[model samples]
Target: MGEDADVATSLADSVSEEIADRLAPVDAELARRYPGEPPTRQPVHTVYVPADAVSSGTVSAWGEQAREMLDEHAPDAVSFASVLGLPSHLAGPVHDRVRAKLEREPVEDLRIDFEDGYGRRPDSEEDAAAARAARLVADAFEDGSAPPCMGIRMKCMEADVRDRGIRTLDIFLTGLVDAGGLPGGLVLTLPKVSHPEQVAAMARLCGEFETARGLPEGRIGFEIQIETTQSILGPDGRATVALMIDAAGGRATSLHYGTFDYSAACGVSAEYQAMDHPVADHAKAVMQAAAAGTGVRLSDGSTNIVPSGRREQVHDAWRHHHALVRRSLARAYYQGWDMHPGHLPTRYAAVYAFYREGMERAAARLAAYTGNAGGDAAVMDEPATARALSNYLLRGLDCGALSSGEVARHSGLTRADLDALAGRATEAQVNSGP
Candidate 1:
């Protein structure tokens, strides 16, 4: 029996080595494609504030207006607040209500835009606007009102706008550094990328900026906007998403879907231009394929619909935002873009509802599955399944939909367990060793 066991072990080792050799290159190629560290607190949405409107207190200001819309249209405090993980039985104080929580960090990210949001301005005015935006960012940092994530969306890197884009970026970063220092959590957004070369140019520019500005190497990361059909379909007739990512040279931090531009580029009609449009989905799929496990976050485009003062108009807008947000959430695109301050109510409402509605069932199944208990068929949680399950709850916690203690209680996980699961679920970001 001992002799037979030794022979079997020897044969198994030999076969394993052969199999590894066959698959080794595939793994190496995948590693080369996706390489970097994903941001842990990726915002669920980026609220674009015009360069002129950016200020240290912009988030709080917009949120107050947003919450008032809440009081007007969504007046059912108990029902609305419950969506944010506030217990129905324990509802008491007014401050602990839904309106207050939404105001707390209403905008997870703020993109001071120098492109469409700022529109065409005189060159001098544009440069001044960039400088002012940097000052406001500095003030926001000093006041402790800065969002967890913040960035500036420069104009497209095309020939006509390339000079202006670099000008704005140069002024913004210079002002930011001179004011005090570049505040932490800063990222640059490169919009309307038509080709992979455009992406590579942005990477090279970022590297130059970092060295000139005395910032650390790899400190200034930029997200590519996948907005055109050409961006996904290279000029050579192949899918260019992976190439675009590779061209970033490891500075590719995130991929943001641009619905309207992409749809228009594909010749889709304006009537059907939307986040749920099929073309938008195709671009998003390409982005996910190229950037998944690459430490690059994916954000869905915003619905243009905005909440109006009129009662009739408000409902339609709320419904539209909610549906779009739910679609993104279902697709695992947790972060998205919010066009208006009024979109806040439904943004949280949809996210909170999505997570809370399924909390109990998911918690029970996870517990049963992880413990190997004889539960329903749903209790069969594999590693990927467990990772996704934990990720769902973690997002709720991050977005204020679920309280830490509550998820721990419901999911049978301690705080440590929850943290461990978040890391496990997101470890896909690191394809290369430190």
Candidate 2:
């Protein structure tokens, strides 16, 4: 409206464009090399059980198994314990709470394995086992006995194992199709991936499988296991994790860590190949950085120390497993693998403790920053903070750690306000990882 104001506006616009032009190259590189932010419902843990062991009613079976474990170890909640480090006085009550959760809600996702869990078998036996496993999964789907998510973990594409892997997958899929149409929320795990070509090959096969079965295109997605050092950093000196996802032809849904194998690949000794070792941390951090905000879920490797029958060994074993799970949660890896039914207690204990320990603090911080009527507003919330808050509540709710009412009450927000934040999370791109 005024001469001086018009001149100032024009100068500001010109300067802004000049700066933006200089930054264009950096912006382009980011978009080209990384994944755009996407919303995901990440499970707390995937229980990897042997194929020969899986049945349609495995969830109920595991629940019963977990109950037996609690009876033996934490009977009457008085002897209750895990790696949670709760005081002796409070251990019993905490143990009962976690036990109730495990029995009511066992595994989040189940991976019927033909990989490491089921070592190579004779062709006949393997083929028969594959068919049987598929039928079992089909039964699970029909009976609604399946967990929230379920899938198969196929062997890698290495030349030595490729034929066997493909054969088993073929037989299994055929059996599943004949039993029933494929279920939703199914994923295939491709392990020991060291090269992009392997990922591309898996992607190509997924396409062919969907076509052959008359399923929607790209309905089948796969998760790659960063088990090899080569997957962390390839020959090109770039992050191989990124390349492998690219090779998946847009069908990559998640990336999983293989603790022992990755540590072994890094030249660590066998006994020292634990999940939270510094070397393991480096690998996991690389994964988080590469896949963050892209919605390609990240899962930590499992703690192999499944507690034994002996009472003396149980405490130490439980403590170790608990610490590892806690460390993984702290690193923003909400999911990991539970290799044994006995691990259910420790895994859930760690998860519940992690959430409850910080729930009030996180809620207060979020409420204070949101500037609601009761909020302090002393600390302004940024886009990333808001995203983290949404992700935190979403994760807690997903895993059944916090009820809807609890989250709403603590965060000082209504259901509609929470929904708006979740909407913003889906559209925003920022790494909210701690």
Predictions in order: lDDT:
0.78, 0.78
What's the TM-score of every candidate structure?
0.87, 0.87
Clashing pairs in 2: none
Where is model 1 more than 4 Å wrong at Cα?
Answer: 1-39, 78-97, 372-378, 422-434
For candidate 2, write residues 133-178 as lDDT tens digits: 8888788778777787887898899999999998888888888788
Candidate 1 residue lDDT tens string, 87-160? 56433333243466676788888899988888989999998999888888877877788888887999988999
Question: What's the C-alpha lDDT at position 72 in model 2?
Answer: 77
Candidate 2 regions exceeding 4 Å error are 1-7, 11-40, 76-83, 87-96, 376-378, 414-416, 422-434
Error of 1 at 81 (Å): 9.4
**Model 2 weakest lDDT span, ten residues long:** 425-434
